[model samples]
Target: MKFQDLNTAEERIQLMEKLSETFLSRAGKNDEEGLFPFENIKELKESGYTSLTVPKRYGGKEISLSEFLCLQEKIAEGDGSTALSIGWHMGIIKSLGEKNNWEESVFKDLCEEVKKGALMNNCATEPQTGSPTRGGKPVTSARKEEGFWIINGRKSFTTMAPVLDYFNVSAVIEDSGEIGNFLIPRNSQGLEIDETWDSIAMRGTGSHDLFLKNVRVKEEALVELFQPGKKGAAGWLLHIPACYLGIAQAAQTYAINFAKDYSPNSISGAIIDLPNVQQKIGEMELELMRTRHFLYSVAKKWDEANDETRSMMQPELGAVKLAVTNAALTVVDLAMRVAGARSLSAKNPLQRYYRDVRAGLHNPPMDDMTIQALAKSAIK
Candidate 1:
């Protein structure tokens, strides 16, 4: 079936499985040495996976959220970092088309880039400013001048900075006295990539810091989606769950294999034969199943939803993101417990999975803040 024909969940899963086989080969190396997965990205471009969400008007297949999640998990099961890195790009692409903005020309240009397998990443998060959690600290300023606007400030965690063909940066718009997003090309003179992503987890994501000083972009590039705060920026929040779901899937697969092969000296034959180990597997399976279901349900609802419906699903998505990410972390921890000390070995996948999965706690809208928002919504 054609990519667009994959409306059913099963078909999407099958396609993702097929994609999973190829995504991991080069990604493993990249994850180990903190190297950028340029080759893996090239494969994605050639495979026509990069434009999975570009609208049909731009000559691309627009997939449902469930399908997108399935694809993200498959790629991530192969390499969590790469899947996450790409998910950010896909989220931005899909989100731009999620609503009917007056910025068709900009979408047209972005779609054109998608056609060429070019990548665009969200440039949010910053030093000193922290997250947009309490609605504060947007030090990055945009000043309107002549026919263009110049942005000045630092943006950290700018994933895909290495080969990002374009960028959608959020800054304080000088003219409007409001926060807005602008499309900036990667090579736009004053933009610089700082390799400051040395971390315990998701290091391969290439999430570096972007330092912009007087970087000028065309006025038309400024695209404001409903006043940042009130516009309901929850769409981008899905990237977190998409990634963790993949990481959890990875842990599940690895644990099953290790269970089948590992033979404790005391156990009768294999680790899987033991009741306790079997129970652990069962628990992991349940968590994986429930998380997957929640993620898919949220995505499907988003796909079939109207703008208002989608906007209201923020609480649901945030819950899924929080639950799934935390589940992945737990699943990885269980896998380590089942595997014993072997899970910590350099050759084992659990260590990397553990570190990579923990990144969700720090990624976007934050778990604590999200729950509080839900609580406040409930109180009101």
Candidate 2:
């Protein structure tokens, strides 16, 4: 069902819940085989979920930030890999729509493509440069040749590489010695995916390496220019924490279910009655509640803020990501404690949830960096 067809946020969320149930069923097989969830993505595109963040002027629902994160959390509950993978596309579309940084025609064209199921993600991380948030210059170089720009570089952590229709790559302009983002179509002459992803966590994300061997694009393909790590406040990044939070919620559900049904000969009732188990469950509920409030409150603020206000919210945004991601880790840990050793069984979803939740620590706005930003903000 098209997200636009739904008149209310609740209806849209219900649609996602229905889609997520199917994604949940295949999550285990995809995680076990390290297979990209192409089918899940296809289903999302068919449901018009992928284009929900496109601007209303572009005929999209343009859901509020709170609604976007809520939907993202729901998707993650079903499959963290698919949620994380698709989150990039959703957030990028929202960010671009909000920023209006690119050429009007160009962005409009891209939005049209998105409405037709086209997917794209930024590829910035490189082996030598590490995380792009660390202020490292991209080794990927772009040089102007005739009327086109030739780009050559390799990018790591290119999530959803398997089905991406477009790659927005960061590269240093050789002539101007400046960083720029180039929008390279998947059919670019020399663009290729290396299939090198092998991380133990988020195994189904397909975050493989991207290689550009003298790929050429029109000069207009240069979409954005900026200093590394200096981009303004990005509320869209909330999708990261939303994803982990959803995984934690899944873990909590599994743990509670396990607790209620698991009765041992040593106990007259289920272990959920035990004070220690009750304590863990209570702690999980507390953290989930706290983080959800923190996440959605900030999302609401972002939705209501003007550009000037939003630009100054970097510290708050970072805090939300830092708080929610870490809390999600805690929640999952407590859930695992509730389940005891059985949580680590290869067949158990908790094991998958545990691994997937940890991946959030490595996503953009790392804890250390966020703390430092908070300190800077406080001091300034």
Candidate 3:
């Protein structure tokens, strides 16, 4: 279905389900070859999936937070890597529109490109400082040169690096000593992508190293400035949990089907009839249902909230990431138990799901940090 044809959330979700069929079939091959899902990305762009989050003012769909999360999970079920790789762009685009953090004309122009299938993502994490969420300044620095800013630094784990049309790179301004995000076009001189990603999970994400050796851009490229240690509720980040939940769901589905089909001579019926197997299945379902409830409820709240109400939800937002991710890990573990040793087979997807779901533990809002935040919130 075309983007213009999607007048409602249901239509957009149906389109994602249709695209997921192809992604599901190609997922294992992409992981085996350690190759990027270029075709999957191409299909997303062609089908106008990339434009779904753009603001309606920019001639895009302007989907709500709940709708975005729901569609994102569907995509993840097909391939975790593809879902995650695209989620950054989806979330950032939506956040930028809602926050209006960039120059109006510049952002509007970029939104126009997004309508035409362009993609972008923030490059904040560095090898030295780790995630920008941890509150360390970027080693990447930008210097003012005449009428332009010259950026020089290497950014690691740049998801969607292969297809990104524009990069919002965070760097410390050389003169002012302020951190700012600079928008660099993909074709900028001295900008290169080094194929350095070799993670065991999310292999198809093409999360390579981004190198900038004196990359230059117009001064207007400074999109947003950072206020150190300051943060607010970010509904868009719900995409991370959405992606992992999809992986867990995939693992659960596989285990259920396997249990129903693997009939043994020791038992007259399928393993699903066994109480132990049924127990695991029931546990997986309970965790998944709980995660969906927490995730969708928070997303729906964000959609209905005003700016002030939304800003106060940072604690809840972090909690959702923390709760949903941990729940997803448990769900995947239960799924593996149901499938037995076969789940560990190299060809089996359960092992892949296990590894991928664990990555969420390392994602932003780490468990320790989330616990601390909750503690501080309680004290206040």
Name the candidate that leads on lDDT.
Answer: 2
Clashes found in each candidate (C-alpha, N, C closer than 3 A) = 0, 0, 0
Better of 1 and 2 by lDDT: 2
What are the lDDT scores of the predictions, listed in order? 0.80, 0.95, 0.90
For residues 170-209, what per-residue lDDT tens digits would candidate 2 score against the true structure? Answer: 9999989999999999999999999999999999999999
Poorest stretch of ten by lDDT in candidate 2: 1-10
Superposed by TM-score, candidate 2 places the C-alpha of residue 14 at a distance from the truth, in angstroms, of 1.0
Q: Estimate each model's TM-score.
A: 0.93, 0.99, 0.98
* Candidate 3 residue-wise lDDT at 75: 89
**Root-mean-square deviation of every model:** 2.2, 0.8, 0.9
> Of 1 and 2, which scores higher on TM-score?
2
* Colliding pairs, model 2: none
Q: Write the per-residue lDDT of candidate 3 for residues 232-267, one digit (tens) a residue.
A: 678999999999999989999999999999998999
Alpha-carbon shift of residue 162 in model 3 (angstroms): 1.0
Give the Å error, residue 164, model 2: 0.3
| Candidate 1 global CA lDDT score | 0.80
